[model samples]
Target: MRFAPLSLLISLSLLSFSAVSQDTNTVTAIENDITLKQADFDSFTEILNKHLKDESQQQHQLDLLRARSTKLEKEKNQALDAMNALYRRLIEDPSLDISDTKLRYQNAVDSHKTNKEDIAMQLASISAHRKDIEKIRIDRHALLNTLEGLKEQKNTARVERLRNEFNRDGTLEIQNTINCKRTETLAACEQRGQHLGMQKATKRFLDQVFANLTEIRLVEPKRNSAGARVQVLNSHVVNSGFSGHGNYDVNLSVTMRGDANNSRLCHLLNLDNRFCSEYSSSFQSIYSPQQSSNFTGNVRFSDPVTVSTTYPEIEKKSQTYNKPVVNILNEPEIDYTHELTLRSNVHDDEVFIDGVSYGSTRLSVQLPVGIHDIEIRKLGYNTFKKIINLSKAQTLKARLVKNKSHLVSKPIVETQISNISVPGMVVIPAGSFEMGDITGNGLANEQPVTKKILSDSFDMNAKEVSVSQYNSFAVETNYVTEAESGKGCAYYLNGEPVWEPSLNWKNPGYEQEDDFPVVCLTYNDAKAYADWLSSTTNNEFRLPNEVEWEYAARAGTTTDYSWSNDIGSNQANCGWCGSEWSNKSSSPVGSFSANQFGLYDMVGNVWEWTQKTAGQSDVAVRGGAWNFAPSLARASTRLILSTDFRANYIGFRLVKER
Candidate 1:
């Protein structure tokens, strides 16, 4: 959104063309092309953090104010108690120091005034602190946004030179498979990334995605009956592994014992899988019941790393069938050849049809009803080629004639295809839960509880949307909030809701971190942001319906509060809680532990807007805010406000439709 002057390091790196070496120039040139410039990026982060508006300082000041308010209230109460006691003594004695008693009473009244003045000044300072923090946050976002422009700079001369070098380099893409061996940690391997694929040789599951990829980095390259060596020839980082930690591409290769068909592809620390030991791995592997010369395989990946949508669970039909024998009573006259399958006795062998390599030994391909040429080859083995006429769905077994004389190695290749599930969303598995307030102690609106079923699973952001996230949306859309243009957000002033022009998501009438949920957004404002997000990400994101919101908030608990029935202090932000933030404003989301569903701030921080419309013009808001009493902060508590209403205590979370 905003540009910052280039840092001294960046400026120096850009200038002094004659003094800078060609290699230095080359590094600077490609820095624009890479996603990470480790050193420069790290330096920039340090600078940003150093200058970051520390909202916590303001929060600390607010805490002190609350403590001061409590202490003053106690002193005032004590003085009044002393005055009352003295008056009682004098009445009993029928003669006493009435002057002293009167003085005590007057002093108590004066103490009350002083307390009020002190608290007012404290509140004012807290507000100023909030303003300061927001400004710092604005600067922080603007600085971070500038990184894209900085990284997008291009030098035509350097780019051309780099391209020329890439063309001249013969060892760019190593077709052979490689393993990481014992080096599991990226740091341990000097940050060398082994472009891993399934190394499992057994064609247990033949899916086209895996079939198309040259190297299959298996879940367990060593455990598929023939624990082969997890071997990496060399770790290649454009230059070499030793120097390859930065943002650049590299090439590598690998091999192991046993038929490659039996192994699932994976990267090892360049150790022969046979020589390396097995460790805890992830994801299920597709197993082929029968190993055929023609392999039918399916593709799958280890978990934590997401599988791409392009590679759907389409099971490539590479099944091997015994040639049908003529049966007059049961068998059809002729099996029309429509689907064709080809396999190799050896794994990772190149299979070619019409001169184009299918990329692996065992492959399934659809052929028109006609004759075709198939070729299968592996290095150190004889090349296999054959011509076959197809009349029906037929499976062809290509026994590669061993190239006992050829010294060529097998090469497998597949094209590369590129969440929040962002970093914080958690998948709430599809399940039916009885919806509504189980405890009847809640509001009448939570009445008429019903048993509802969620037909489909959905994802919910673990934490409420933060200020930084909302800022990005606002910047991209050039959007303004209802509060900014309307009556402004309703904030507490002298113990009453008052519209303040300074009150906004950026200020939120309190000091808060970027991690704090953004507030003062109306229902329409929230919806507009949701629509923009859906258009941008092509994912259905919306405010949760009241029913879904309560279900997630309850997280399978029937308690009044998300944690349990008893109104516990420090569990949420509310007026009744004598916590540090009590009767002040929202805290950062997840300040307290999350509920059973791993959702943070489900019951407090702010009353989240739900999709449920109330009456004729209002929108439903749930989970009370910092200013509300604990009773209203319960999961079952329901409050509705006009569609135009925006307050420092109103915000919303996200639910992605699945």
Candidate 2:
């Protein structure tokens, strides 16, 4: 009997052992792949089920909105029919007065119009819910398709694996039969046939493994002949099997091609050498033919991933329906209040509405829709009283006649009038008042109320120093303000004072009209302006002392502010004081109601520099500016600023001594 060569048998035996090992590994890999694909399929199924549930909910919501819309439309039609019937009754009934019938018809018409709007809004909501339901259904369908595709892919992989196993087994059986016919014993024939089958299977596995290899590269550092480092670069290895499931240990033999002198070019060219000579140089480098690298790692395979699933959201709308016409007309209660704007000839006369003082005229108050007694009175004017049945908003102008008896008994002061001799100055009457925080809601500096008595009257500016007035002084004296000469004026930014090099009195970081108060002044600057004014007018013009400032600011009233203690709206131009220019910029002089002494902006608009000194280098400023809080605008609130400091919120008003 003829037998195979010893070397050939040994090679076949080794191939058989390798084939068995590879088969076991491949089976495990296929099982893992199938498991991952099944998990993906299950995940997609869960998403599809969830979307189906959302679709049901959305459909139910759509149905409810449609039903509500239909009900609203029916109610709208009924309301329209009722309105038409009411109109026809008004036209047919001759005994019905136009007034009573017209009111009822108007109510009915409003009810019908409101119902129509509600129906339209309901229909719009229904349409939106329907669109939401449609989108949910579409998403559900996509998820279902994805699940089916995953299932099909998983089944196909299983089929391919089973077919490969069957082919390998059948080839082994056929080889066994052929070898039995050629050999003497059945046992030897079976062994020989098994070896042949294994050889074929190994060949198939190696062919597949090599076919999947996309690239083979050698990556190492390049060194000079003297073993000194020269340059280094990177190389990459790519394999189609990277996307398959298995762990592999690949051994690579790299050989350098070309003459030893020019062997460095092999790394750049990526040339493959099969019969290169062994490198025997003292330097053992990457260029040696026998050098090999072993790369061992596990390649993880990923199945087709399920897409992110999101369900459409249904919009919820609020339901609003108009009250019935009968209910609206038969309602017994009414608003009963009407706005009454009261005016008087005297600018600062006290006004009383229903015996409740509503500050001074011109003012507005809401009076009940009934008879209200209105009273307007001043110190020397006859009390004007009126009784009016107010059912609607109206403006009442009262001209008070002078009470000769009161005026003669209590002689009026001459300080009530502005001093014509001193232009733009008002005579402030000498009076005794409790200065400081009489309201007890002020700062520490405003505490310890003290009674101050001014024995003499003084002529003070009726308004804050205007931009026009300061400009006149600047032009006449040809003087540059400290802010313009040195550092620019400080302005409020982000709730803190920031010194801007570009800002000055003329440009206080915001636009200012000529009539607005002039700000960004230091104590010395204000003193200089006062000196200039004193020289020009031949009067002693100077900053008011703190006591004089508080006296004039309080006027005759001992309240927190000149007008009242409440810091009422539209009374001043300070921050949060309820003026259009509050906290933004200084308003024009006399923009708000004046104090009782006919003084404008005594408590707000700008912090005025006073002649009083607080510390060695600090000067007292009275009132508050447009950017300060309302509390800071109190009559007694005092701010001590450095004498050389200049800011947008600091300005000055002159007091001319009489």
Candidate 3:
């Protein structure tokens, strides 16, 4: 038999050579076989070397492909991570719209997954290529051995048959090569497509997230039923009977006035159907309630005043015709009983005295022989008692000075009243109290005492800002107080008081007096005064809020009067209030007396202004005035007025905060 190529024969022998032996006659055959095997071995070695080189190149290509796939996978994972981070950030930012970002990010994530899947799928393709290449290498090795072995065998027929078979196998190998090449090319294309998609998705996600950074909104003001913004300026003081008048302007901060569908004023003024500015004239000033003072005096008859009887000699007779009789009866001849002097203890400066029904520095009365008991009382001052035994003709002298210390001024102490030349200023402390009122109490508004806490301490005037005080402020600041203007106020001239139309702070009837409270002022004017005081004295001065006013007035006592509930005696200086006002006009601050808070003229004088304004209405006023009742003077009472109108009963005070 023709032996296979020596290389193949040796390779097969290695497998079973241990079972066979080498010897002599075999030596001759072995020598020839050795020579032929040597030739075949050389040829086999040459072909196998070429095949190995080709297989090595194919393996190197596969290795390069695997490395590229690995790199793509790493890139895909990184891109996916970036996309996820962007999505997370977009979701967390409150201002950002993450829908577009999410869409792009999801696409990016999907693309990365697709890339990985593609790579994985390509792995199978690569594996197939590897297997095909390996198969090709095996086939080439076998064919080469067959070709080499046949030449050595020197059998022409076997050579031709092996060559034909080898050629047919080689042709089949070409098909395998073509398959591997096609698979590798398709895998590469798929990989490139996935990578491109991933990159685009990543870029899109980033761009979307970056664009989601800017978003904001502004809200507009809503309109009321009146289509106008009715603002309450603040509480103001007005006389007891006068109607309060004030102006309110709408705020056009959020919407333009021209753009509004309709504009009107609402509240006590009730101008909702009309333009707000039109009513400005009506509210130019408010008139406070009118108050009337009652008068009482000691009836006295003395020789100094009786001289008029001696001069009365002229008599009138009847003019008649025939029988006219003249019967002129002379005054009855009687003894002129001496006029006795009566007296009371009370100061007549400008204070409202209680129980006397008259205001006088000294009260005097003539009485028959009897024992008389006399008592002295002032609005805010304590009473003085006196029991005297009197003869038929006796003269007595007595003094009535204010008695303090009987009232508790805890929330507002009397010591805080600075003698500073500033007009009508008082100080208030920081505290909590109920404001407003309910029905059970006398005043309609004093019943519901809403609890309020004040964070800062402040000061207020002991009484309303008197005309005298306002004049001083105007002089110093070159500014006008509302009362000073002749717009709508009563002015005290030389020794008489009159309502003037053109009299103002700039042209006052009598501006030199500094004891009266500033009056006829608007809310803006009060604010200006507060500002000026702060700037000039380095102190914070302002208006008293409703809560502070009640707290200060009550002064720890929840009673009608600071001294007592009975309004007959220990009340305040007011006209027709409790019995009478001694027939007088506005009394000075602290003239009637101070409340438990050491606040003077809190009631029965002029209504004091507060910082609070009526909601949806004109400005409000507090404390009762001279013409008001004792019930109205309760700390919880509330009165309202227009901003532009002024009256004789209205007044205000100043405040400072520490």
Candidate 4:
């Protein structure tokens, strides 16, 4: 049924009959045959490869869709939070005499509602892609089923062909060709003319070859190239009276094939693959049954004939499983009431937790029993940040070392900050206060409470650089920010910040006056603008260093804020400050009163970029933005950002150091 054992096929192929001087043609039609070609296998393999490629592409699409769904889920939660905050305010909001507070609240509410709808649409798109993934899986299963059917068809055809080749009509024709005379003289043939040894040998050969197909066809030596061999079906005709016993004769013919590379092994050890080789030989031998009266016949086949063939195991791909998505919207709060001792190799290096300043290293502090972000930093040395999992009180020690860090060049522009051409700037006298040091807020990195001095005086912008000025610069230089060149700057589209095209400072997803601070400017963009201003104005204007900015922002006062410990309404633009512009993007320059240094709009409008680089790709941003909480607006609060970071709440102002 499976391709017949090589020996049986060869034996059947050798059937022949000879009646007289000339042999009879036995295989008139039975010999003509169809065979499997190597090309057939090649074609099937190609089909398999094509299906595999399609399957791989579908899987890639599924992975991308899954990621999109996860992002949308996060946006949905953020939008809900924004809407809730507005609702709470609307209930207790005072009927103030300043502006239309109700209308402002309604507009913000509608914006969040729109954002939620957009996220829902994205989720729906993911669902469609998921359905496509299922369809691909089903199609792949069908391909496998087709492959199984093809194998079944090939095997069935092979069995039917073998049966047709070895039936009674085919055997009768062989007898005539081989001159095997079928007679009824039983006693004469068995007692006097039986060729027992010959009979036993032939039978044993057929039995052994048929029983071990795997060994002979796969493990043993073989050949696939075309060749032929002949095997005789019977002995020549002989009568018992010719001698003391009847003589039996058998004939044989053999042929072998060479390998594709002409290997001699294949030449000598050719296999009978139906299409690769064809030969037949009649059984020929001589023996007398009378001489075997006391013979107990025994026939044994030696080891299998070693064949040479190259076959590689076939491999199939298995299905892959993808884990379900999980959105972690909230984490359980930890009660960190106990204090622990922490020490560092250097005394002046700062420490931090969750990017907030608590105290410097080598101090006792209370932390949650879970994971906390611990960092130690110094200006010249590389900052070390780690996630520490604490369960109990323990003393932690750290070693800080300096890396090769390059300081920013001083501003080259020398024009008055209050020049009338652009938005005005403010002048602050040279002074110092523990580096504008403040306690009670920030990570260890933000906790440099030591009284460091600012020796040189500098002039800073009275307000942040505004949109109109930045746009003029962009048009003049024909320069594009990283976001514009790639995806756009991050804007609050549907409740959370997402990168959108044409969403740079020119269009920060909101209506704005020209005097409002430009938002979504990357650190490099701010630096580029400062250099341009220096070249254009013939003055040394550049962004302020972290220390210089802090000194001026503090305005010579050493308190939690530039004004008071508790910031009230109309003080600054912040999330909880209750200002008219709270959580509503940047306010116009000079919107807020000036600090002691006569500098206005310093606390909040947009987060200002500083000329300070952090341990990672981030630079320092100070003075918090309109959307951020009041704590971020504190004089000492600092946040790190990637050099190319661009968000709607971020911007920069310039300073002239002398």
Candidate 5:
């Protein structure tokens, strides 16, 4: 925000260049002063470098010497050790190598008379060499004086020049400052003169330019004296330039003034610095204390930052203390609310608001005002975000729709009928396959992939029997489902519903829905319905084996889900899975696109009961239903529910062998 003033900035920049020149000149003067000493210094440095290199070489040589010495010591010790074995020979004539120099000396004494005469001659030769070395020392001492004298003269001149340069630089700075002031003052005077002349000469020119403004008028306030309104007639907004230090000055005059209470004129100001105070004030309060602490705090920052979360602000607070302070203190306390909702498809989706999860069609949560994110998760569905901006009262509605994720889905290999016009039944083929996830896809026991071979083809009701289908079935059997049974509301009759389960299949709970799948059927009731169909049609009508159910559900691929493995609105329906799950739950059998074998709700939707239970005890159910994650909807996925336990989402489809 603090931009340098243009002219002053240029002046300071120019001063820096001059200062650099002065610095260079100072260095040159210093160089001249030391010129005489250069040779001596150079020679000293050269010798020092050579000495250092020699020292390194000497160190290596010393290491070699030490190694050789150790070897010699070892050899000497070996000789000493061997001496005991050769003790007799050593005593007789000394086996170690020693020359008989004493015998030679005695021979010399006897052959030539004076041994002392030879020592005198050697001492005289040593005396002559000492005299020559003394003269050489004298010559070196003289050379030292010449070098010292030259250095002294050069240093004196350099010191004088440095004093003069310092004075000159200060003088130049003062002169420049005076000149700049004069120049500014003269320019201002010239500008004033020109402005006066121009005003007189361009009066008519200005009038012509201002002619359009004649129609504009200033309105006075009725009674209040605060302000007046300047209504320009037919004025068009042109280019709006920047304000403050960035823009040029413009001149305008107000024609009238208005009262305080009823001002006809309104002023709109673009304030740029209002928020700056808040930022700087907070920063000063926080950082000022930190700077005075014993441990030097290193958090330096400018004002007007964009961090909106309290976590980072807390971290900034914690930084004020040293490392030891963190160990002794408690963390700051905060309170805020979090809300989640379902988006896109409402009917099959439910939202988890606050902490309580809803499998219902819709949900909402009331949260405390603060920064919080919502997770819209649907079982067998993919989760998406609903940015929670609950500053005021906010309502978030997310519809759970499905999205496809893969190139292919498991194949449902069942038969097809050419006419395919059976009132409301969808025909499915029969085949053999491993029922459960044999490859360990993490599905339950009903998925125990046993090899089951269905020898005949079969017809399955396309969807779980709907209300209309169940009503027809009920009318034919003259039996009512427990949900539809009169006042008593039919409780468990011998572990099975009193009414035919498929009587009003479309409205499982007797809720009056004709398209929804029927629920509340026992194993016996389901079998009874299949038995009746087989007798009437003269075809093999029995519950589909677990294998046939998965094969029909998966179609063919072994992916965890059908409809490309993405759960949600695109595939099947089930509970309020705010997100997509691999095995997310059920839909009405045909809610999603049909698999290759033309079976719907194979991946998601209700878990269809199968004839194959683990040991004739646990009921086998295939294909994950709604309110579940996508992981449970795989072809091999399985779950078991008690036959008597019935819920809105739990429904069944019938299969028969042709």
Candidate 6:
């Protein structure tokens, strides 16, 4: 064989040394990685064990707290039963005035309250412990998974080392086989075959190791049960009365249990949980248990008063008056009747003779010729009373004084003739006016602007009825508004009307003073009010007919509005009427200039109910409201609504026959 060159021999030696060094470094690095991962796995395993031990301890504590809570609840119930028995015995036999027994009952009540508080505290503690246990279990599970991943990494590193070793040995064997010329030895061929077999076996082992790591799965933590208990206490109504025009005052005891979610109670009042919690805690600390606290405040009602002893929460309500008990004695009958005419400075003041309504003032009635007690009453005015002995036909006049405390507005100028002028009313002269859309640009309903004629004069309310006026009728007659009796009134929200069950005339989604025109009235409600007024005033009080309403609204004007063809500023309260209360709320009656006929709020403030019907079960509504646009507020505009439909934008004005 030819002698190899020195340079070639040196190159071969250097290449072999480089390959061995590379293999050695790879194996050493993989071994170091396995060592570090093994150490981390061991450390994490220890931490997971510690977390598991803590979780076990917390679970045990939770169990103990639950048991204690149950015991306290049982004891509290027993104490309550004992107190109830003692109370019943005392009530059954009032003769027994045993001080010792009373003391025992008081002690039992105190004990019950103490037990309730303890139970609450125990439950709170248990809840906290359960949370801690859940956290610990979660951490422990994560740690276990991390340990398994670290162990797998360690195994993978070892397999990588084995692969490196096989590569190095196979490379050496291949080199030796290349160096052995055409005539290869048996020993070299056997070594090459053995290296190939070893490489395939190592590859299979590494693949198996990866498969085992991929198959590892972690278990999820179990969920815990959550619950709470609620208990209501007995309540008693102490005092109640009509406190204001549309509100009442009720002094009562309210008791709320602690450690319970009272969201349901808050929902009943259409309030949030935070408000409920604050209200409940106002009586006593939530940490303290059952304690009866006295609550005294004005309770405004939109519905009938139905007080419950179990729960004394504030509800929209109206005052209920109890009829006075009367005792009649046998007496001789006097059978002589005479004509008696009643008159008052306030023309329509309600008159009562001998405690019976005899219609309004400027009224003629037949009364027995004897001593009679007479009383004249009007809203926003003091009552006028007198005792009269009438033997013949005579006119009795009483001057009513304005009640300063409940004054709604400056006294309206009274008409000169008491025989023809009614209080809060204006006499419209018989005339003809162009009804419907007098302006060329109006809706289809306003079309066919025809000439409407009124053959006879009629009296119409100068201004829409105020809250104070309606409240008087409601209080006297105990009439429940349709909005209050049914679902509720339609209140505007998000640029549209929404049915708000909690809103009514008393609370129409905004604050209203006594003088503000009453809204949230259905056609039936207006009819009922008119009927009541007629019965009390001895006049045919009813909603104005369509032709009459349009004629009155036009006020002898052929323009779109009473002032002009265009909606003038400060002329009315509407969406764009340029009034301060426009689009926000209904203004007080007479807040703006009146129409030509001296009638206020005929075109705005609130839609007026009319006697005319539009479609089946639909009644006609005239004018417009503060929440409506100027176009809707035009004198000729007309809208029809269901008889039972009520909203904050709807009200009424009455008309009396002349």
lDDT of 1 by residue, 1-658 (tens): 1111211111111222222345346546566444454454455545535533343564566577677668767776877788788878878896777786677667767766776776677678756655444344333322322332233222223322222221111111232222333535433232222222112222211222222221234322422322121111112222222223322122322111111221112121121111111222111221222233432233221212211111112112222112111211132222212688887788877665533445684578765444555667554455687888766777887775654421122211211212122326666655566666687766456777888777776778788888877887898778999888776787755334667887778877778887888999988888888887777777788989887887788766678875456554455676545456867878887776566566778876788988855434446788877776666777877764556677888898888887
- Per-residue alpha-carbon lDDT of candidate 6 for residues 1-658, written as tens digits (9 for 90 to 100): 1111111000113443455456556546656755665575466556645655765676566566667657656765666676667678879898766566556656655765665676577667655654554444334323332333343333333333322221221111011111222454433323222222222222322222222221112100100000011111212233433323322233332221212222122232222222222222111111111112221111111111122222123323332222110101122222234788888898666676544445677889865444666878765566798988877888887899876641123334644232333348777878887888767756555789788778888888888877887887898789999889889998766444668998899999888998898889888888888887777767799999899888888776688876556554555787655668877999999876566566888878999888955534446788888877666777877765557778888888888898
lDDT of 1 at 309: 13
Model 4 earns a TM-score of: 0.36
User: Can you give the TM-score per candidate against the true fold?
Assistant: 0.36, 0.43, 0.36, 0.36, 0.33, 0.37
lDDT of each: 0.52, 0.55, 0.42, 0.50, 0.39, 0.56
Stronger candidate by lDDT (1 vs 5): 1
Candidate 6 stretches with Cα past 4 Å from truth are 1-423, 614-616
Q: Distance from true position, residue 188, model 3, in Å? A: 99
lDDT by residue (tens digit), candidate 2, 1-658: 2222212111113443354456556556656655665575466546645754665565566566566656655655666666666668778885655564455556655655665666566556645654544334334323332333333333333333322221221111111113235324433333233223223322332222222222212212222221111000111111101112221111111111111222222222232110011122222221111111221111111121111111121112221122221132232323335789988888777775543456888898765445666777675566799988777999999999875541112212323122222337667877677988888877555779888888888877878888877887888789899999998998765444668887888998888998888888889999998897787767788999888888878767778876556565566787655568877888888887566555778878888999955534457888877867666777888765557778888888888888
Q: Residues 434-515, candidate 5, lDDT per residue (tens digit)?
A: 6566557452344445776666556665556554554555667886544444322222222122334343343443343455
The pairs that clash in candidate 2 are: none
User: Which of the numbered candidates is closest to the native, going by highest lDDT?
Assistant: 6
Estimate candidate 4's RMSD in Å: 35.1
Positional deviation of 292 in candidate 3, in angstroms? 45
lDDT of 3 at 274: 16
Q: Lowest lDDT 10-mer window, candidate 5?
A: 169-178
Evaluate model 3: give its lDDT: 0.42
Q: Which residue runs of candidate 5 sit more than 4 Å off their true CA positions? A: 1-434, 438-441, 444-456, 482-512, 564-570, 576-589, 612-615, 641-645
RMSD of each: 26.0, 42.5, 57.8, 35.1, 39.4, 46.0
Candidate 4 lDDT, tens digit per residue, 1-658?
Answer: 0111122223322331121101112221212211232344345445645644655565556566566556555655665566666667667875423234444545555655665665566566655554444334334322332332333333333332222221211111111011122462433233212233223333333333323222235313332221111122232211122213333222212111101111111222231122111222111111111113233333211122111111121112221112110111122222323466778888766665543444577788764344555766654455677777666787778777765422211222323433324445656665557763366655445765778676666678777888877887788789787667767787543224567878877788777888888887788899998887887777888888888888888766676566555443466786545567877777887786566565666687788899964433346888877766665677887765556668888888888755
